[model samples]
Structure formats: structure tokens, C-alpha cells
Target: MTKLLQWLLGVSLLGAVWALVAFDLLELSLPRTYREVAWPIPLYLLVSFGCYSLATVGYRVATFNDCNEAASELHEQIKEAKEDLRKKGLKM
Candidate 1:
């Protein structure tokens, strides 16, 4: 399955289970403590996902590679453009 579908399926399953437990819809006779914990579970999941996303972004940025050749080529093009502009009496 696609990543989005997989994620949605997982989330839906978790939410269904959480609803059943938090609301006692199934009459499972779960303890009150369980319900108390289940109430914050969504917030915990959101915070956990946020933390994971931040860590992934930080790791990728830390390991990102620099393109030196492209940088120099861009600099040369800029210089040529500036020269052309100067020739056209566009003082800078």
C-alpha cells in the first residue's frame, strides 16, 4: 500500500481502539485508570509524531551535501550578467 494509506489505516485502527476503550463502547469493563490514560493518548501520539518529524528533518539537514560546482557556475553567470549590465550603462 502507499505510505499515506498505510499511515491512515494505522491511525484509524488506533483511533477506533482508543475510542472503544476511552468510551467503553464495547463494555469491556476496563478500569477507570485505563480510560484516564487513553484520554491523553492522542495528544501523546501527536507530540511523538512531531518529535519524530523534527528529528528526521534535523538529521537530513545535518547530512545534506553541498554542490560546489553548481555554486561556482552560478557565480560565473552572475558575473557575466553584471558585466553585460555594466555595458548597458546600468551602474551598480
Candidate 2:
């Protein structure tokens, strides 16, 4: 499946399970400690994911490469365009 749908399904499944346990929807009689722990787990997960995403973006940007040849070629194209424009009686 597409990545968006996959992420949505996974998140929804986790939320359903967390709700079922934290709210004791089935009256399973889980211990107080268990419910207390489950309540904050989603928050912990969200914070950790945020940290991970930040690190990943930082790493990728730090390692990104420069394209000097492409830069020179773009400069040449701009010069050629300017020359053509000048020949066509365009002033700047």
C-alpha cells in the first residue's frame, strides 16, 4: 500500500489498542500501574519521533553535496540569454 495509508492504519491501530487498555473498555480489570503507564506512552512516542525526525533532517542537510559544475552551466546559460536579449534590442 501507499506510505500515507500504511502510516494511518498503523497509527489508528495503536490508538485503538491504547484506548482499549487505558480506558478499560473491556473491563479487563488491569492493574492501576498498567493503566497509568499506558496513558503517557503515546506522548513519549510522539516526542521520541519528533527527536528522531529532527536528527534525520539535520544529518541529511549536513551531508548534502554541492554542485559546482551545474552552477557554472547555469551561469553560462544566463549569460547566453542576456546576450540574446541584448541583440533583440532589450535594455536593462
Candidate 3:
């Protein structure tokens, strides 16, 4: 699905940023070690998972707002139609 792809993309981007920062910190704070090479992948995965969760929440919020707006518009149209019918001596 398009939404799945979007979430994957967002997660990848956030994971990349997280990996960069984490690698930089490790490189600066620790001496040369196997962890420097080994840590990034797991770190990326963890960060990506977090990012994906946040993205899903954001997507749901956006979807809910759009649906709410559409419902409001439909209610307004129904009210207008009823008003017009009332003018023509029809009652609901």
C-alpha cells in the first residue's frame, strides 16, 4: 500500500539520521572497537521502528481530520437542502 511505503520511507530517513548521530557519538566517546561496526544496524532498526510508529500516529491523525472536515461539509449541505425543501412547503 502507498501508506506502508510512505511509512517505510519516513522510517528509513529517520533511521539514517539516528545512525549518523549514534555513530558520531560512539566514534567520539569510545576507543576503536568492534561495536563501532556492529552497532549501527541494530541502532538503525530500533530507530526506524520508533519512527514508523510515530509516522503511523501522524497518518491516522491526518486521516481523522480529513474525514471530520468532509462530514462537516456533508452536514452543511444536508441542512441547506432541508431549508430549500421547507421553503417549498415540505416538512421533515
Candidate 4:
């Protein structure tokens, strides 16, 4: 159920973004008679949807538990091993 809700949320957010982009395009291309009463709706929606999309990206990034720190630590260990090997004239 949680996964389903998450999927729905993502889909709805993307749909909102698509709607805003479509609205903005139509607003630019269509005649004055075909335009909406409020010109800001698309811009507002676009910004809001953009924020949500960014938030989703942020969430994913946070969940990933990045390995850069671990990699750097391992690299430091390797560097120390190389230094020790050079000091001892040992092949490693």
C-alpha cells in the first residue's frame, strides 16, 4: 500500500508537470481568445511541480547512502600501504 501510494504520488506529480508545460506552450502559441483568464497558473504550477520533482530527487539521494566517503577511506588505506611498501622496499 505504501509503495502504491508512492507510485501514485510520483505519477501525479509528473502529470502536473506535463500539464503545466502543455499549458505554457499553448498559452504562448494560442490566440488571445483561446488563452486562460489567468496567465500565472502555468508558471505557478511549473514552479510547484519543479519543487516537488527536486524534492523527490533529494529524497532518492538521501536514501542512497553514498559510497564516496568509503571509497576515499579505502584509497587512503591503499596510499598508506604503498608508502609502507616503498619504505620497506617491499613489492605489494
Best by TM-score: 2
Model 3 CA RMSD to the hidden true structure, in angstroms: 8.8
Residue 56 CA displacement from its true place in model 3, Å: 1.1
* Stretches of candidate 1 exceeding 4 Å from the true structure: 1-5, 67-92
Q: Which tens-of-lDDT digit does each residue in 1-92 have in candidate 3?
A: 69999999988987676565556644555444644664666667679999999999999988774578889999999999999999999977
For residue 15, give model 3's deviation from the true position in Å. 19
Segments in model 3 whose C-alpha atoms lie over 4 Å from true places: 1-36, 65-92
lDDT of 1 at 50: 100
Candidates, ranked, TM-score: 2, 1, 4, 3
Rate residue 59 of model 3 by lDDT: 92
- Residue 79, model 3: lDDT of 96
Q: List the global CA lDDT of all models.
A: 0.96, 0.96, 0.76, 0.76
Off by over 4 Å in 2: 67-92
Worst 10 residues of 2 by lDDT: 32-41
Over 1-92, each residue of candidate 1 has an lDDT whose tens digit, in order, gives 99999999998999999999899999989999999999899999899999999999999999998999999999999999999999999978
lDDT of 2 by residue, 1-92 (tens): 99999999999999999998899899999999889999999999999999999999999999998999999999999999999999999999
Instruction: State the weakest 10-residue window (summed lDDT) of model 4.
Output: 30-39
TM-score of 3: 0.31
